[model samples]
Target: MRTADTEPEPASDHDGQHFVVRLLDAWYVACQSRQLRQRPISRRIFNTPIVLFRGSDGRPAALLDRCAHRNAPLSLGTCQDGALECPYHGWLFGTDGGCQGIPALCGSQPGRGHRVPRFETQEQQGFVWVYARADVEPKTTPFVFPHVDEPAYATVRYQATSPGTLHANLENILDVPHTAYLHRGLFRGVERNKVTATVRRFAKHAEAEFVGEPVPKGLLGRILAPRGGTVVHFDRFVLPSIAQVDYALGENHVIATTALTPTRDDEVVLNSVITFKTVMPRILIQPLLVPIGKRVLAQDRAMLKAQLQRIQDFGKEQFVSTEVDLLGPHIWRLLRQAARNVPEPQETTPDLPAVFENTVELMA
Candidate 1:
């Protein structure tokens, strides 16, 4: 059996916390095409703010965001060949974030003092990802969908950031019971009572299987929820922080990863990516398919964001946990643990691969 103390402590009760060290990875809401088109997008990557700009030669550059001369946001400046021009003093920094030119002073050479710190960055799957701490690197490869990765998936991403918590959103999807009620007309139809499910966990991940029904209970009930083989859905919490969702929607096996990086104490920006595996040839149907997928995705995001805001405004009240709340509470615990991923100011980046909580300990 488990008690409250044995489970990971909530961030709300933890005395001090930082975002960078807590999560193993962070995803930037970047558009590779859009990023390359004009000026770079200026976004805060977790606790550390950063400036990204494309040079005249069209190479992407990332700087520590603060100008070398003074602590000013360099993103508010212009771009030269692989360099960022600081708006504050008009100091131009190269792709490596080295100060290239100082407009005010005539310099014999751009001294070492003119350089700004740089971070590790990768532009993939039409987004940019930044690693704040220099020493850390990814253990497993980032999830890239072959279908989307194909030069075909016609993707256009838009982000809506709110003052919501990361754990709150992850719980929404992992908690399948909510999907029946919340996304009734959308993700699923009206009748959900036909589907029977049971959940199991491993290491830091938890999964639920629709063991009973593959057919639906309503008009389409028998078609979707037949006398069930199992449809497995597992969620793994990859530490400092990352979440993986694997589920099958008919012929489509979908996997989505959302890395929740903290921007501020009360807010976390989710960098979510989805990959689909389908037997259908994507070329002919992709134009129509991507939009359908995007619409469904948009619906889920709305539910999560709105529910989070509501809880913030009204404040949390105590709830009686039940057998049905099993998957939801179990998920809440794991995500809360990950949300504490930021490293402490004094600690060095951890050498170990991201750790997962003991699921048996949780469910016991």
Candidate 2:
């Protein structure tokens, strides 16, 4: 793992090459833990095909989708006795990707070197994470969804694919200004309120804390903060690809954490886990929240698809952001730096000042 102050190796000048190289070194969410069962399932990350299945112990395992013998897809096979059996030749592979049995040999021992490439995998918070690089060990754990499985907290999970770049999708989730327009009555209205946001940028993370904000007036907002006392809001971004939005109103609190997994240059998968602690029972809260949350996500997905189509038609992006676009520029910078494998300054001590800090007024 590279440290904050360490110098990066010479990276390719080509943006696409840099993107592939840098992103392959990190861990990405492959699928929900419940999705993987007795049969093999296929997924793609960074355009690389992968197969996921459960071992005999019921633990998740990930491997390159191709079979070592004839390049057939392992996902087309079946799982028997904790080993993946190739459909073409009935070869058996263990969780570690080592070929354990060869039906053709009739009880003969398989060669030690015959195996498929396997990636590191772990199950956390009901999601299965797979490290992209097969040889390199993961330096950090998967991002934890806040307040999940905690007492008095109602959780809802959502998954969707957006036709946008990773950066664009992340920025859309962490951007606040769009909520007032794109989300309109469903999430936030076109109401104008002068709120001060203190933006802070760090090496691998960025956050904006808002003050003097009024309670939201949208449909969901009305349901969240009906009494409308004081509202404490925050939007944060974690490096490589995670965004979190937190809202606190006295005893009521809501947190939405989204993790982005890029499948291609123009396609990305969003896995969002929302946890809220309010004066409502889980049974009632979940039933009411799922539809509203789905609507909000659908709105964002349509907007991103249109945005991506416009950019494609124009042959490039021509975005002009203002000061109110708090986390967009910061997220872009961090992603670019990460793509180049360049390290920024880390927060060494609690008293250390932020790399960049500013207060801006915006209407929510």
Clashes of each: 21, 0
Which window of ten consecutive residues has the lowest lDDT sum in model 1? 355-364
Model 1, 59: alpha-carbon shift in Å?
4.6
**Model 1: residues with Cα > 4 Å off, grouped in runs:** 1-8, 12-33, 55-59, 134-147, 150-163, 194-206, 215-245, 249-252, 256-262, 266-274, 277-323, 326-364
lDDT (tens digit, per residue) of candidate 1 on 143-195: 35335555423332334454444555555545656655555554456644344
Please report the candidate that would top lDDT against the real structure: 2
Question: Per-residue lDDT of 131-191 in model 2, one digit per residue for the tens?
Answer: 9888567888877888899987888999988878787888899888888888888766776
The residue ranges of model 2 lying beyond 4 angstroms of the native Cα positions read 1-22, 346-351
Q: Give the TM-score of candidate 1.
A: 0.69
Judging by TM-score against the true structure, name the best candidate: 2
| Local distance difference test, candidate 2 | 0.82
